[model samples]
Target: MNGYRFYTAASLLLLTALFTACQKSAPAPQEESGVNAETEIIPEPNAGSEKPQLTVAISVDIAPYVMKNATTGIEVDIATQALPGYQLNFIQLPYEKLQSAVAQDQADMALGVQKFKDVEGIFYSENFIDFVNAAITKKSANLKIEKVADLADHKVLTWQDAYLELGPEFEKLFAPDSPQRKNYVEVADQSEQVQQFWDAKDVVIVIDRSIFNAISQAKGHKLSEVDYASIFPEATYFKANFEEADVRDAFNAGLKKLCSSGEYAKLLKKYNIELPNTICDSKAHP
Candidate 1:
């Protein structure tokens, strides 16, 4: 009778041990978060992403074009989209400092660089952006401006350097030597230009459409009541200047790719910007 009781107790102990062992050896319950799943592959942050940093110089004055935020706007975005292989770090300086920064090696590249006659020691990329200048007038004015010459009939307002920029025909007509030169005013401040245009209903402003819209709309001006005439040629191309020729070539290639893939147009619309002329409009390779 004692052996039988002892055997019963021993069997119970053995069975409990076996049950605990089985439970311990069983596969872990599936995690609700799926972290332990066999198929889940989570990438480590910054894994194998050792891209070189490219310091780009940009204008601080041009709002909506410069560094509007930490990682957006026309100048910052254009460089970011154009150079995917390298990380871009933009240094916002004044308009005059853009070229000097690159020239002095303060930045690796500069946006909105133009190849001036006397400017040297810079590698310019293919014409990447067009400023899209136009002859703006009031919609109710009924102005017939099919060409640059027609602007002679009305008061013209333009940027300070418009004479050298708006082609020889414009230079001949309104830039200089016109008896109406007093009526054709060129001011350095474009914000003033927009104000002046709206202040005088008959005034025709020679300005970039995007810039005009940017300034005008910000000042609570209604665009539906405005009219623009694109008389200027799309020759003035915007380029990125680089310290190295190789980098310039790389940027050109990337720009071409963006245009081909149609991402360039999408970016333009994202910023509510457009090309001055219909010739390329961020589509052409050149």
Candidate 2:
């Protein structure tokens, strides 16, 4: 009778152990949290691991290069596409304020800045784009700008800081006490300058060919409507800043890749910008 009781207890113990093992190996019941047996729980990416943001300070509203529209411009796209690991931010500033903004650490870089004066704490990158500044006047005005000196007598309307930005020669010609300063109007508003040129026959506006073309098209004015008496040589421009040398280096590497990949050409073609075949000969700031 003792052996029979012990065998029965042993059999019950084995069955209970087997049942517990089966229950432990089975899947748990789904909860109200929406997690199912087949559900995949992917790890969320940390926001702190995102690319560092970089910034560009732009002075003028050069359409097709930099614009107020949602489509943006070629320069905007180029900067963003060139740097793979950077998030690009842009600060719109007046032409006169661009340099100061860069100087004061208001921005990381300033685009379209040319080398002229011996500026301290500012470093310029390799020339990325060239601008052809045209001296424009209405065909009916019969304005002749064979040389820079001819601008001395006219009521010339130019973008702000044109006196300093153009070159040392332009600086001398448009100096405060120079005869040109009497008639030279430094307009901060580019659209107003264009409009004033149309309204006043005596005013001559200096603008980039690409930008003028973009603006003219927007205003329903044909290219034939205006005359470019004299256009400046291709002026190479560089990005300027104090502390973002590494960013500039990365940009150059990306730019070289862009050119070799044929993407740069495609971008220029898309914006109807004339392709510059030669890189600027000098890196010393033109």
List, in order, the clash count of every candidate structure.
1, 0
Residues 43-131 of candidate 1: C-alpha lDDT, one tens digit per residue? 77785678888888876545456535336676677678888889888777655566578889899998876666434777888777777
Q: Write the per-residue lDDT of candidate 2 for residues 69-142, one digit (tens) a residue.
A: 31378777777777888887888888777766777888877776666665676776666776667788888888
Candidate 1 accuracy as lDDT: 0.77
lDDT of each: 0.77, 0.74
Worst ten in a row by lDDT for model 2: 277-286
TM-score of each: 0.67, 0.79
